[model samples]
Target: MHYTFSQYYIYVIFVAVMAAFSYLNKLNRTEVFSFFMYAIMLLFAVLRIDTGADYSTYIEMHEEAGKSYFTDLFSFTEPLYFLLLKVLYFFSDDYWLMFAVVAIIIYTILFLAVKKLSIDPALSLLLYIIVAYYFISINQLRQSISLVIFLYSISSIIDKKPGKYYLLNIIGFGFHYSAVMAFLIYPIVNTSFSKKTLTIIFILSIVLSPVIEKLFVTYLGELDTLYTKYFDIEEYMEKNYLALGKVIVPNLILIYSLIKFKSFTRYEYSIFMIYFCSIVYYNIFFGKHIFIRPGMYFEIVTILYIPIFIKKFFDLVTGFIIETLIILYYAFSVTLYGILINGGQGVVPYKLIFSR
Candidate 1:
């Protein structure tokens, strides 16, 4: 059975509660409630079944992990990725345990990352929901773990610990090869971009998206036979604009926030650059189908940035007008992603194995 609207509303209420707690906890200077909210999110993640685009695929992977020995596993995957799976599988082959392990790692990294980076943690979690980072985590298994490592390693990069930053991302790469992209944040964090440059780049990306899309597919397809099949430029071109429009308002708003809030700390700049690259590839490029998947790496930073963005942007003046826009903005984006986009395809109609 599909997750009904009632099930969808449950997630909406959950986001609202976490948002409220984040705001309150920030004011109160205690993270007790925020921690509880983190637990709730984790529980939801671990308990759910038959969710995510890769839910069944991961189950098959887990069974493989259960059967494969050390050497055989290494032939296909990074050592650590299979190692962890093997270690876990030694205990049981249940997919729930595998999901539990990944859920813990993701929520833990996100919880810690927000605590370190955001002025308001609850708001960050709220933005996480609205911006669909949490959904991405639920969908992308290996990359989710990779992203956790990337998020955790941001501080090391910001603090000028290049050795540690690179090392962490190297570890992340073991989970997903795409994680090597995290290495770029080190340089992007240090470089400066004027607002004019950012604006020009954004416009150029929009104009050249179709060209960029074709170029990327051709280049990557030359390197990998898989790319030709997975990154089909023609198939994506038709549907790309529709997906782009769904989140355009929020993307533009985020860009505005990044621009307005710029005096660029090493961390903020890193977040902005990641978000910028993703926008160029995912939104501006015509074949967002494939790009948006990877583009989410940068986009996830919006979760960390949004709380600070809202606090600073809206603090000077607060009113029904401001509050309504902000609230509606997030609620609409959540619907656009979770329902209108795909009937909450990946995460809605939450299910448990026992329930089934």
Candidate 2:
């Protein structure tokens, strides 16, 4: 008995309403609201919708590798996601149930991590919704799980423990090699910045814009071919470019806010500047493929910074309203992408569960 689009829409609205109510009741116990949000996200995961070819690829790997090798191969860098999936596979063949459990765990971790970092619950919740519903909800198995690992990695980095950060990055890479890029950032992120250094980096970022495409084509063409064979990189790149303008616009706003507020810690400033430069460079030459799609991962960081900037620049009430509006905007935008543009049908791809 497949659920219809109307049924899924009702389910989503119910969850969203519940989340909103919990968010509105600030005087209520924090744990209670947090738990309710987690529960709603779990339900959404249980009734997940996936489309496009990524699902087919995951299922193919599952069938070809069996349970053991499936974990071993996929765990390459994302040990937590691979292990979690393996445990679920051992218990049952119900992919939807497994996805729900994973989603709950991911959201819970992100919530706790943000709280530990001294962020507001409302802002943290907003970040979770943006990532879960907008960027990840439509592709629960690979990208969503990979995002969980990425969040953990970021938490470790925030704690100022390089060892743990590296280990988490390794785990993230196991699930998705793209996460390896986070490690390459340690040198840049850890270094003390001077005005001269910032100028050099900004210059390099600008200069690299046009040449990046040619460099990728000439030097990294084989790598591109390999990615295409394994991950359908071309198709994703094409679709990603469609909304390039929208993605770039928000990032530009974020950069402007960061510069105008000027209250960032050195580390925070480094992250903001580096990512901002990357976004600009990506926008100029490669269109949206460079920053917009991958940039979604940084939304969590961006939300955290936005609130800090708001607090520094405006009164608490005004800051709160601004953050709330940002959250609502991101939430609606993500919802539209997942529900309307992505043709989300609330059907988990059962073939990816186990060998039939």
TM values, all candidates? 0.83, 0.70
Per-residue lDDT over 194-276 for candidate 2, one digit per residue giving the tens place of the 0 to 100 score: 55565555556657755775666667667655544321334544443324323543555555554564556754664465455
- Name model 2 segments beyond 4 Å from true: 1-29, 49-85, 131-140, 194-242, 261-300, 332-334, 337-339, 342-356
Candidate 2's error at 27, in angstroms? Answer: 5.6
Per-residue C-alpha lDDT of model 1 across residues 1-356, encoded as one tens digit per residue: 24556666667676677667755775687778778778988987888888766788888888887798787866856667778788999988877888889899889988998888766676667666565667677878778788878877877867889999999889988898877677776787667788788778777877786676577666764543444335354544333323433356556765676567557666666666666766665655444344544555566776666554555566635632454466556656454443434454366666776784
* Top candidate, metric lDDT: 1
- Candidate 1: global Cα-lDDT? 0.68
The alpha-carbon lDDT assigned to residue 212 of candidate 1 equals: 66
Task: Report the Cα lDDT for candidate 2.
Answer: 0.53
